[model samples]
Target: MAEETDHESKTEAATERRVREAIEKGDIPFSREAPVFASTLGLLIALALFARGQASQLARDFAPLLDDPRGFALETGGDAMLLLSRVALAAGRFLLPILLILAVCSLTASLLQNLPRFVLDRIQPKWSRVSPMAGLSRIFGTSGQVEFLKSLVKFLSVSVVALLLLRSERTRAVNAMFVDPSQLPELILTVSIRLVSAVAIATIVIVAGDLVWARLRWQRSLRMSRQDIKDEHKQTEGDPSVKARLRSLAQDRARNRMLANVDRATVVIANPTHFAVALRYEPSENPAPLVLAKGQDLIALRIRAIAEEKGIAVIEDKPLARSLYDAVQVDQTIPAEFYRAVAQILFFLFARAR
Candidate 1:
């Protein structure tokens, strides 16, 4: 029975840890579109990088095959197949490397922007997931409204760009039909440039919309209420009362340990109302002074009582006492700026001790 209880306790602890990790992750679901977009962009970049070399190699490899059908068949299939296969393999050797590097880069880029967190609850079998009414509601949701606006903006931007590009290319577009055949390439080049520029403009608009969406989505994900955090802590760390008791016990023990050092202190500085700080200086062992104990209010009063019972000197300097209590913590030396004032107090104490 004891062994079974221990096992159950361990299982409960594991469940709580898992819940805490999920809460810290902000419960964001993975979006498939971002990864797909990243991979596509990476592939485009990879293709652009090798465009010239790959285009030239392809031309060289295919030009001879295009000229003779028998030679093409023989090179591709028959007696010359081995040599043709080796050539083809050699020509395509860099393709896999390019693809793998781009894929990894795309995955890394996507992850760096926002790590996809899987939440089973989001995709659970519910009426909402499959309902037409639910779908319509989402389509009319704030995010859905933004999506509609973005689509409208994209359409308008693309139409404007297309119209501008067409207008700019109108003269060359018309001349292409009547001009000499030698001018055909120039007209084609002009139209291609216009189309590419228009497409580039459209891409920029889409990217801007994506940036806005990413920011908004992250903001929404990071929102958490005070009660939600409290509930999450309860779920993750067990009851609030138990944790509070543990913390209180720990603090009490710490205070006792600090009071135990009261007899060892060289001096005690008091605010005479709500603050007490004790310092211990040993010239033989410590180069600088150290705080032996410090406390405020009830703890402060307790420290003062312990000091009185131990016959430790109690010095009252309102500003110096307050500053020491605020700025320097227990077991730390006072700062250099207060050295002169501290020296005066120490000198008086040493003279009185003598």
Candidate 2:
């Protein structure tokens, strides 16, 4: 039960690296509704722009065939084949713009939701996808159920909207029936465009809502377990114990270097056991005394021992040692606040040497 609880608890949000890895694996947020919405919009626009022209062209092209089929020299096989070819060419040219519009709409819709990316892994076939159990699970899964429900709702809603719009346009449609025969096509085209536009706008609202929900669900699905977070941190930043060992090794090398410089120090001021600061001054080259090294506790003992071994003076002035250790750093000149005390010590050492 304890193990189960631990496994169930995925409270941590996924890291950026995790999300990026998922994208590389082609596991990304997407909404099927967006493409549907885009295609509908594209179709509506294409129809609005080209419908009347195409209708007129179709009427003109086929008018002769419809009015007087016997006028064609169809008794010859060559003439019949030529007529069929011309019809095919005309139909292809007429539909090409709408097809192009739909393709562009689908591509643009996908690009807006997710930046273009190609992952070979997504195209590779997986055994799980072909498994009977997997298929059954997908059909019964929470996501599948939700998708089905959403489709049903969309179909019902669109149908109701379309019906209501058609009812509203009933009077105009009836009046168009009595209009001049040539004008009837234009009237029907106008009403059809308006109805499609209304339906497309309504579908856009549904698609927008689905997109927001899908994104939230995608993020939630990517949430990390506590152990997963820990593993990623280790992978990115290295193990804590290993890092601590490296830090300790670096500190030891720096301390050895600092102790070696203590041999050049003119004087060492000590807090006896807790702190030590070593000072060096060159009258011709240095404007003020410089701290050669400063340390506390174990490091302080090592600094004092090095000073004694090098025959450098070691003085126990608690207040001055603490002040210098606090205010000065290794290889830096003592600050003005500590100048008087440090200068007196340097002067006394010089006098003794003389």
Which candidate leads in lDDT?
2
- TM-score against truth, every candidate: 0.42, 0.81
C-alpha-based local distance difference test score of model 1: 0.70
Kindly list the per-residue Cα lDDT of model 1 for residues 1-354, writing each as its tens digit.
884454334422223444466556455334334554466555555555663455455555655554554664453356587657857775676466567756886688667766666766756788987899889978997768977876787678778878888897788688778865444544554465456555554666466557667665644544454455566679767997998999999998988899999889888889997898898878896776788899889988888898899999999888888888889977788888778887788889999999
Which numbered prediction scores highest in TM-score against the true structure?
2
Q: Model 2 residue 189 lDDT?
A: 78
**Collision count for each candidate, in order:** 0, 0
**Would you list the C-alpha lDDT of every candidate in the order shown?**
0.70, 0.86
